[model samples]
Target: MGIADLLSDVWGTFSHPAPDAEAPPTGGSSTSSPAAESGAEKEENKKDAKSDDGGEQGHRPSEGGDEEEEEEEETVDPKDTLEDECKESKECQPAKHHYDECVDRVTGQIDNDGKASEDCIEEFFHLAHCATQCAAPKLFAQLK
Candidate 1:
């Protein structure tokens, strides 16, 4: 539809909602649609659903709040963890330096197409391998 028609529909929705948007007339044979329920009524329905099945469908807390706190407390950014481990690893220094140099060299070189003339995938892989070896144990230990 055109923009004008779309805007008109939106305006009409706010200015004058559809008849079906209102709750069904009370004390009648008509069934109420879920959409017709108010927020409070919906919440009450959720509570009733919980009671119907012994609270299985209810909004319940985690089995142990300690687990939640432990998870939050131990949450470390992987990037930050890797960088910290790499900084302390002597074996990763040379590969990291080489990768940085290769990146700088490649980015500084421009071809006739005005793009990087070379990629440093090999250097990057070397750096990544070294870093992963140094960081894996420490990172994986946290998984448990």
Candidate 2:
């Protein structure tokens, strides 16, 4: 059969389901379609979401409320992070000693090899010490 005939037959059969089927019977006094109520609910949800976002940003807090204090607490200055890095690097005196030991170890390995040139050995130890004691994981990541 042609597509038109197939569609018409389906349309005729679909006018009503058996009375005991899952769906509520189609004929009713209600003015609204089920699809229309879903659309209206979507619009209401969008309005509620927009209102919440506006409350977060636009409405000015009156006289030191919880929101304003929370906002102030959340902010962090860039200098604070820089100061933290500086304090950590400066206060850790043991790392300098650790780096010196690393240099000595690498230099010893270089000297143990009979054919390695002294100048190349010095350069390798310098780099190896920096990579090890200063930033082992960072150096390993770069190698990978």
Q: Give all TM-scores, in the order shown.
A: 0.43, 0.19
Question: Candidate 1, residues 46-125: lDDT per residue as tens digits?
Answer: 77675786545435554877655444467668857786678557888898788889887876775345688678999988
lDDT of 1: 0.74
Judged by whole-model lDDT over C-alpha atoms, candidate 2 comes out at: 0.54
Error of 2 at 116 (Å): 12
Error of 2 at 121 (Å): 18
In order of listing, the candidates' clash counts read: 0, 0
Question: CA shift at 101, candidate 1, in angstroms?
Answer: 1.1
Give Cα-based local distance difference scores for all models. Answer: 0.74, 0.54
**CA shift at 87, candidate 2, in angstroms?**
8.9
